[model samples]
Target: MAAEDPSVSGVSGRYATALFELARDERSIDAVKADLDQFEAMLADSADLKRLVRSPVFSADTQLKALAAVLEQAGITGISANFLKVVTANRRLFAVTGVIRAFRALVAKFKGEATADVTVAETLSDKNLDVLKAALKSVTGKDVALNVKVDRSIIGGLVVKLGSRMVDSSLRTKLNSIKHAMKEAG
Candidate 1:
């Protein structure tokens, strides 16, 4: 695992950096992270929320009103809620997910931690997950946080991405290699 560069300079990155700095200064990093996580989960679980965030059909006022209601229902408040309202008002709601991800990356870098995006063919057991985490920690020599995703298209095995590095051990890749080798041999 490796930490992402803290100097991300895109629009989303700038917004995330500002929010991250604000959270740090206000001593609400954990609270803001939790709020963002909850909102991200909501975005994932509700098609309507996803549409509201991404679709440009809704005016800024409409988006702000709907987002405020959603945030209230989700129990989000304080700086996090106000920050979201500002984003909505600015018509940047569509990039909220990217902003959240960039913020998480910045926080992890600030904390001297690394995040590994691990894709597996199926969900791992808790025991397996622990072993994987241990391995990543050993390799990175830093606290490694796992962002696990399950994609059966991999057929089997796992793929791990840490910053600029990636290790692909998926069965699909192995089979493709074999197929290519056979073609060369023939």
Candidate 2:
């Protein structure tokens, strides 16, 4: 199944597949997923952590030490911590984000859930998130997991990408369409 997904191909896919299998064998899929999600969130939130993961300047020892501290502080343990340390030791930390994403895809596939990438003008309230999930579930006929991103450039409304299909309803896009239509009229 990983071979069928373009996003889950190559090195990241390989690591993610191995991690997923290990998690399954241990029956700790949810715990591993949560830990990976927390790590990914930290990567997104911390420039220093991102630099540590992505920069070639950091020696394996340095990265390992820093990562150990971070994981311990974040309360990440078990398979997730071991997997991360192994990846760091292998010097593949630069691709950790892709690995995490591929792992998420594999988990979604295993759980029969559809993952949607959603871009909104601002952070959504929990109520709005639940509503969106319900709507997506109704359409996909499966439990829907949302990966929401806030992009102020969208101006308003939201954009949803489910598999190969994308629906863009942002104010920026609507205004651009109106501008194009008016130009064609002239």
Candidate 3:
């Protein structure tokens, strides 16, 4: 399952694989995925949660206590909640984001869908998202699930990573290339 994407490797991959197997066996793949998505969204939205997840200053016990509250508040119980608690107890809470991403990749593959990591200067509208999905679908011949991230540093345009291929059309890259060319000419 981890053969194609190198993102699913080492510590994160192993944990993700174990969670994936459990979700698959229990036939709660959708429930676990939704819970993980909620957790990821919370991590993105809350600075304190982000710190709790990424900072090693917090001991395992503190992280566990904090994570328990978070899971309960988010109503993310069952296998997904257990998985998070296990990760925290193992002192691998720092890599939870990667594990979630890897788990999403596994689910996407299992469903015969291709997952694309897309970065844009701003959030794309629903219409634009549907158009991009259609375009990617045409290319990959599979339904594409987009993981969209916003980075203002891109200035404009977007960058897409599909499997081993990446298309970087961001304004930052374009400007950098032009600057490099002028330097070479000078």
| TM per candidate | 0.89, 0.96, 0.93
- TM-score for predicted model 2 compared with the true structure: 0.96
- Per-residue CA lDDT of model 3 for 96-141, tens digit only, reads 9999999998999889999999999999999999999999999999
Q: What are the runs in model 3 whose C-alpha is more than 4 Å off?
A: 3-5
Go through the candidates in order and give the C-alpha RMSD of each one to the true structure. Answer: 2.9, 1.1, 1.5
On a 0 to 100 scale, what is the lDDT of residue 125 in model 2? Answer: 98
Index of the highest-lDDT prediction: 2
List lDDT for all candidates, in order: 0.90, 0.96, 0.95
Candidate 2 error regions (>4 Å): none
lDDT of model 3, residue 4: 63
Colliding pairs, model 2: none
lDDT, model 1: 0.90
- Model 2 residue 3 distance off true place after TM-score fit, in angstroms: 1.6
Error of 1 at 64 (Å): 1.3
